[model samples]
Target: MVDQKTPADAAASRGRGGAPAIRERLTRRKPVEELVAETQAAEGTGLQRHMGFWQLSMIGIGATLGTGIFVVLGEAVPVAGPAVILSFVLAGLTALFSALAYAEMAGMIPASGSAYSYSYATIGEFMAWVCGWCLMLTYGVSVAAVGVGWGEYINELLHLTTGLSLPQALLAGPMEGGLVNLPAAAVVLLSMFALLGGVRESSRLNAVMVVVKVAILVMFVAIAVTAVQEGNFAPFMPMGMAGVSAAGATLFFSYIGFDSVSTASEEARNPQRDLPRAIMFSMILVTAIYCLVAFAAVGAFNWTGFADGETSLAGILTKVTGTPVWAVVFAAGAVLALASVVLVVLYSQTRILYAMSRDGLIPAAFSEVDAKGTPCINTLVTSLVIAVLAALVPLGPLADATSIGTLFAFALVNVAVLVLRRTRPDLPRAFRVPGAPVTPVLGVLACAFLMFSMSLSVWLAFLAWLAVGFAVYFGYGMRRSALERV
Candidate 1:
């Protein structure tokens, strides 16, 4: 009775029922310091910490080398003719520049949030939320896009091997009167479960897939390069610079996953040391592969035949080799590569949301961890939305939107490096971008140029998304920002 009579005990008990005590309130809604502290405490949680430079390089390759090379080739070759090779070089340059910028910013921050986190610390709270939102939508839509792409190729492979295939109406989108894209939805669901298991497992899976993808391309290249007739490259730029620009903009998607490697900085064993090397290595490797593939694909087929039909590697096999077997293999490769891409993009999307949630920009549930220490709630919500998208919508709109969002994010990251250097000279940087002002400026210009080359419809849709993002940020994120409380 005497012990229960204390005023301090009663006040503490009442505090639990009222608003949380000051310490509890502050802890739950973290300030920047608290956020940093929490992240530090949870070091080496989702991803393993022993990843070496070689593993990091493989991760970059695994992320970048898929869907882009196998699939985008069919779409890009017709745009620029043989000069599509040059367009690849152009896209590679922009990716490299942006990657350099990301390397510097990511190293300095050494955090899990990727571009969104860099923007938050350097720019402001509002911009960070906008970037985070855009990253989510970009990667989320990419999952659906990749899944749908995967279904098409997988069906092609089954028919090739078994001499049986599903009808178009059964396999295609609702607009095409299909009930649902079953295979595409299946791949997304499967990838989600794989990711939920753990990051290390996913990385190993990606590494194996990347090796398979590279080996297939190497076989195609080795066989096709010897067959190059001089006449095929005669009218190299038949469509000229306009065509080159269009192709560069389209081929830009091939380079999409390079930046994604940077997204794992928070999980990297030695982010500052390894991130730049990984980004550069992946870009150089993919650029060389793309150029070689473009050369081989064009060498084997006449330019005129491309105008008559979509110039896919599979189509080339059908035309030049007069055999359906190679076509089947190319299509099978596309299916596998696209499936891997969907998995990686979806993983990146959930992590970005998890980061934002932890910072109080979104709902707290997004950051909540299950027994596995994965953001189970965020993963489920993201995968479900992507699966629904795959089942219904056509892929064209979402794919274009994804490219625009990526270019915009990349441009901001380049600028972010410059901004940080000026504002926080004292911050320890694990990596520094070589050029001070000029390099980042060129990076921004290159990205902008590619962005303008995109369809006008994409620009309009992007603007609309941006406007909505601004509204959301001002209305909710601004007041709830953890940075503000700090």
Candidate 2:
């Protein structure tokens, strides 16, 4: 249990030597019981439980499906050749490990904080802060990254339909020789408006978009698979296993938001019953669709041609059909696909901050909700910040940074599963990761394996981000924590 540190308890701890007292404070775990109590405590004034299995599944599928399939394929195919299909499979397996652990934790804890709250309940405060910090980077920056991808398809759509596209000055960031990415900024703000309206409405809209995008991809597969050139499959592993591993690391960004379903715990009507099923089901369905698209795309077009960046899959559709109509249709689908990603990821970002702020780790403003049970101030402020990042940051750096942070967070979650199983054996868990120590151990190793594939520059950026997080914790969260103040 997370014992509240009264003045007397603090005094007693201080008497037991300074170093020991500090260590005790840092490793303090929050009780699962109390976490649930707080959920009930804030119900009428905080997030409402409006999500079901269907809405939760949409959160995972919408966030994962179209983002990487439509955007990253152009980048990843060049690196891994036709074997980019294997990269998708490799990335999917890595995500499966983490998803199993997430299912167990969501069943036991059911907190909106996602991996952050799991760490707080299983490990301690310091680790929880680290996980929350990484999640902030993972979800927030990824929304911007996907927003930039949204701009790519929007430009493609205009070019296909009207023979005119937005100029470079309005299409990219300073690093890419453009003034600002206007479409990126515009889409994020539009998603923000949707979020501020309410969670149920936002989710319903996302479900519709998910159906549309799926149909579009299925249609592409049907048309493109028939035109497969046998020569395209030769020399598949051009750059070899290293290239496949590297591409897998990059493609892993696509799987980043599947766990957003776990983050929706507090908003789900039956978290224990629905969250676990949704996580596994969504991951399986998305992986099947992703691998199918990659296989069809590679078979239909020479892998080398993907490097040309002509919106590969859409371009392939147009090539096979002998018309630009398919490209236009595909581009329209991409717009909706990426917009769905922005909505789900942006929603995850706000909820994680809400949990942190409620625990006094950040400002209390983040925890405040309006009559409709939305964090009005939190949504607006986060949306504006993300919109700025989308507008000013280049997609490459944003994507690399997001993947590193997301990998770190997923590794921590795997460790949390091991920690909780040993520490809280009596806790009632609705779902369980099958292989115990072995499974959770492999999950951690798999996450680290992919994380090692990133470039040195990306690793340096990850360390710098962590350094800043530590500063914030010591400067603000350390003393202001609710565990201490209570």
Candidate 3:
């Protein structure tokens, strides 16, 4: 007669006993204590922690200051008029609430999965998987969106400076009535190769590019200040509070990349101290820059003027200075800056995949690190996928989809922080969100509000994307989960 075990005994065996045990384990939550142990164990897995606070902060800035200000502003300013300045502040505050929650989670978790890891340890595997799925869409599509934005500015710069342009078929995506976005695809590949060179190299390059990005904005502001006519301030709130809120929802994408700082927790020398500082610092710095740029652009010319241009900043500079030369320079800075955004976004994407793979939720090869201590395989794989997206999809829908995914992830993270505080009060946390439940509650509400502000079409696209994610999780991820194997 075959030996049989009771269900309790089998469940007590941690899912290693048999198929029944494994299936039972699928419903089991990964305890906070176990996740902490796993994170400690991963330190010896060949990924090095070489980043400091400043480098990590630059990564946040480099990632966040790209397409939102450079491209989206062309559309956003028209919605809020001169009051777009308030939109940036409101959006920043919304992001700050979630960023604070993230800082607390990063301090305690010190893991690569960002919100996914936080949710897994505090919530359950299903929620964790959902968070990871949302993030995969957020970062992956964000990289593609930024790449396409870069391509647009580059083509615009060339047209303004040299009277030359790439063929429309090579510049636009199929959705935009073109064959493929070759320039967008090329930028994604470039960022991939840069990442393959290793983290320190990429960080240094990002730092330099960030400086260039900042300098161009400062120069534009200095010039725009001289051109400021009091007349532009007349219709400051022409669109009123509703418009400001709507523009805030649109500008929320600008703040999405600040969370990328926490994704580098596994790669930071002192994540507990550095991660929190980087998150806050990056958010504050980027917010100030955004406010200044919005003020300068709308002050220099009527906000109405910005609606007519493709590259808002560059166009503003050209109009103020009465020369195409400044616009070309601004576009060059934007191109380089947007490339850094792609680099950091792709970096976050690969690292998130690395963390998921290490958990056995995906293929193990993605977790494999190279001699240089980089997830080169994951980077290569992510590059191919994102490159295809950039080449084939239009920028507008991709940006909206990314924003919705990010808002969902942010809401989940806030809930994770609240849950962990109640469930595991004993866990050591280097940082904590002030105001406790209130702060996180606000974060949840704010993210939900922004998410709902998206168009019905965007909602449909987001739901369709999530439906596909769920199918993938059940079909592939569930069976191969490391917890099930255990």
Candidate 4:
């Protein structure tokens, strides 16, 4: 017994059905098939797959197309002038770099955790936990971000219909000197009830909502184009590239939800093929809409007129058509659009948390399924948290924070593709990023450039968030992780 083991014996022990050394435990990669098997084995309890190509595509579009165009265009135009169109393109290009990577990974892994799950199978357990933490920030905070936008537009509808505007104190959050954001809180609660109805029902509702919102945007493009003034295009780059970059960084938050499509891996009818298609299609459609809307907005109205972007489209419609009728209609459409965002993104937030829970990184209740084939406890808890934030926190800084977290998650996803390709070249990929190391490398650089464009305050806030995540991981996830028991 004391004779000791050979190198082969030592290596064999590492692959045995048990936990290895602490260092090995931290870096252990969950096998791709094992990831799918765990979900398949729990068939009765796991999330059911029902969504087809169009439904999956709607989830991405519904979530990705809101707020960015509805509310952000107003905020962006003031900074970038007519160049805001360029900002939208820049952000879309940055997102495309990462989206290609997401398509490759989603086709291979097809797990609910998305980038977090992808990181686990390609990177390691520890990195996966941190990635999940960033995703929590991305989806959870964006719910509140879009909810606040919903509240703003709902107020616009009220003002248009009855000529009564809600007081600033009632509409704004505490940071903005308002006591509570009632509509913001109300929208999230409504979305929670919708989720409790089950994924199929919710997806149907989201698809209808998506159709209405997209039509509204198209109406804006048509009506606004009639009033386009060539004179407005004279100083297109007034603020120059610096302003364009800043606006692009801010607008990056708008592109966060396309990844929500990947989070549907376990719910998609044919994730291996459909997920990639949905993600790419959503990006192209959303980007075209963004550019068209920005172009029409600046052309139809002076960039200086976008003083308050929350209701920019409605204002532009009113100014162009000279009637509050079209404005009211646009405002109503925005209410639908932003609500759709809350619904789809809330669904995404729950699924990501559910994935983390199954890995033993969080409470088990999140992973538990209800009779309706949904995570009731998880949905209820996430909705409540997001509702509170929507009611109390201001939107600007939170939106920026969401962008940074989203970019951080996307950058890691690009890295994961490169890692997996090199480590397991034999793994089958239904979709592949064309240029590999070079493409992913550029994605990383693009994300980093945009991140650096943020103000120092945003960086400080993000680092504070990362610190708390590290604390949670070391204190609980490390010891309780499912891998530790393997």
Candidate 5:
């Protein structure tokens, strides 16, 4: 007699079908503990239970509080006037929704490489590759952008202190009438070496730099606040909604690196407990700092002055107080603080490539580990690319490109949160988005809106990069992908 199986057994034997099959495959891809184990084996125990709440918080702050406050203010104040404070809140809210969603996924997966790994386990191979590709775009260009900013600040500091500095040809980018930014390239290389040394070194370095950066920000607020003229806020919406939205788009960069905390989830001591705290705390802290800075900056300087340069904060301070000392301090803080940002962003970029390489989506060289147990080859390769870009390219186009790629990744994570909720409801989630469909939906739309607010030129360049990504994905990533083979 033929044996008959029960309904449950039958259902278990075959997948839910088509999309369900993919979802089932994704669901069974890797368990939370197993992913943690793999990450520990690769990244070493440095990231394991070694991180506590304080350390995690530092990571978030160190990564998020960089060029945004120092430089983005110049771009934003011109657009939103004193209302740039509101723009920070708007961007923070949107980032918060996505951060919560990432917290859920990060807690569930407990992986170090970040959203790339989370997408792999929740979404399919194609989407995973796309997200990884976009992450590379986000962090790599961010490194170059920060490096370029660093060069400018270093130049300013030298001029302030010694009354002498490197020639423009050696200190600035080619477009700025320089052959290359040597100081920027040197910092990128230095950061790469520091990262390759170990995460502990990286974190400690980050802690020290973060403290100095925050101190400078506090100084800006403390001094600028006292100089506030209420009249500055009179035409709060001078540029109107369009300008506010434009400012929101740029302000989003200030919150960009907050997600790096999620990337470090695999190494968290208690990701389910700590990841949520880290992500939320970091966002709230950054939002508060940025809003205060905006309030003080607008009150201290006329919005009309923003058009003079991208480094408006220091310039405004010079005008408001008529003291070069404040400008010197601000510029010095920016110079030092932006170096750490470059370090952190470059680290993230290399690791993403390392993850992709390990997964066989990219060249194996990226996966090669050195005696120090870091992806040295990958980090060096990234540093080389960033240095070259910093030496030759203008930051405006590249910065906008990074923003576009990041927005795309953020939008994907929001959608993936909803998809995973419906498809794998039984799966244990350490954290769940509070408003479910509403939050994720709004997150997607907000990211899209900001992405659209970028110039037409940025959109065109982003499209070109996406086309290149598609070429890479289809040409090699698809066939070689481990998930595809599975």
Candidate 6:
């Protein structure tokens, strides 16, 4: 008798609450505790943890040791001259700040989606969506750009070894006065099918390709060292400090593959321990190799010569050896190596979408896994999109856009680390960034500085892409979010 309410009255009260529910849901934050619990539950049920440190490290190396070294050297060396060696060091330092941040967050979160998942658990839904959107731009465009670079190497190999090559019209995009880059599209499709096959199988293949890639680079370094000319070192900073900074920003794209390691957090057998080590190891290894290769290549051939060669590394080898045989070998190695990069990048893109889909930010179909425990539909969709880009877009613009998108993602990752540390001081991190606040602050600043160094046109394209993402979020993601129902 004490103020009992009827069922209809309770229903009316619920309806009143429903009015604000959309706003509340749209802004809802996924707490780190819940994210951690969900990750544990998912690990117990799906997403097998099979990757060890070496396999994961190989993935990072495989993704990173491709286009930036093979193709970007041609563009960057021309700007900074032999001082491109310092550019490599600067870019590695910038990448290391973010890598350290990623290591801490990855150890704490131990989930896929990398920065996007970190953002959701710390910053809220809106920022998570933004990070995920930027990642899509980064991985998607990178796959295409790397594919185009692979096509160039393939043509160089065929022309050198077989005395035949695809016609220029078929080997380049329409923007480059060609109808389509058939080889680029073909490589993307191949990598797509390899990824769809299974994660374990794809990892095995990537590991093998990584070995081949490292071997060829070592061979190039060994041979080119014998032909070093001190004359090439003159005018080392021809364009001065500004150009070195600019070149470092341009070459920042090379360091991006290390984050792919963090994306595999859910698949790592011991993510908390292995991820941080793998991230740092791969970054250090790649940086060392980059510095060595830059030094060797410039010493073997004039830096100005690199600007004129599409296949820069191979061209340097050819000039050093006084024959095309070594260049052909390098080209073959590049073709195989870049294919691995495409595989890893494409896998990263699928897994990121899978995470977003599971959060109800995208279609649930994307998160659907097959018997092999891979997101088949997501892989297929990502492959198709990347294939189109590879076939029709030129490499220069796509490469710049990829760098901007990646830097944006890196900046957010650093910010996420700082926020998580402040908000959840009690959370256990398997790997902590060396400096609290100081390290992550510098990481954020470094990423921002590089981002601003990008061309204005690339920024405009990035903004347009984000605008489209916002439209999709409002039109579909907001209403469909699983948290809304909760």
Candidate 1 vs 5: which has more lDDT: 5
Q: List the residue pairs that clash in candidate 4.
A: none
Instruction: Give all candidate RMSDs, comma-separated.
Output: 7.3, 2.0, 3.7, 3.4, 4.5, 4.2
Which candidate do you rate higher for TM-score, 2 or 6?
2
Q: Taking the tens digit of each residue's C-alpha lDDT, what string does model 5 give over 339-373?
A: 88887778678767877787778988887766555
For model 2, how does the per-residue alpha-carbon lDDT over 71-139 read when each residue is reduced to its tens digit?
Answer: 888889999999999999888888999999999999888889999999898779999999999999999
Q: Choose 1 or 3, whichever is better by lDDT.
A: 3
In model 4, the Cα lDDT at residue 71 comes to 80
The C-alpha lDDT values of all candidates are 0.75, 0.89, 0.87, 0.90, 0.77, 0.88
Q: Write the per-residue lDDT of candidate 4 for residues 160-268, one digit (tens) a residue.
A: 9998999888788778888999999999999999999999999999999999999999999999999999998868898999999999999998898999999999888
- Point out the worst 10-residue segment of candidate 4 by lDDT: 1-10
Cα lDDT of candidate 2 equals 0.89
Per-model clash counts, in order, read 0, 0, 0, 0, 1, 0
User: How do the residues 203-255 of candidate 1 rate in per-residue lDDT, one tens digit apiece?
Assistant: 78877777777877887887677778879997999889999888888777778
Cα lDDT tens digits for candidate 3, 437-458: 9999999999998888888999
**Better candidate number, 4 or 6, judged by lDDT:** 4
* TM value for model 1: 0.88
Which residue ranges in model 4 land beyond 4 Å of their true spot? 1-22, 308-311
On a 0 to 100 scale, what is the lDDT of residue 361 in model 2? 93
The candidate 2 region of ten consecutive residues with least summed lDDT is 13-22
Name the regions of candidate 3 deviating beyond 4 angstroms. 1-27, 309-311
lDDT of 6 at 222: 100
lDDT of 2 at 123: 78
Give the number of the best model, judged by TM-score.
Answer: 2
Off by over 4 Å in 1: 1-38, 44-50, 176-179, 308-310
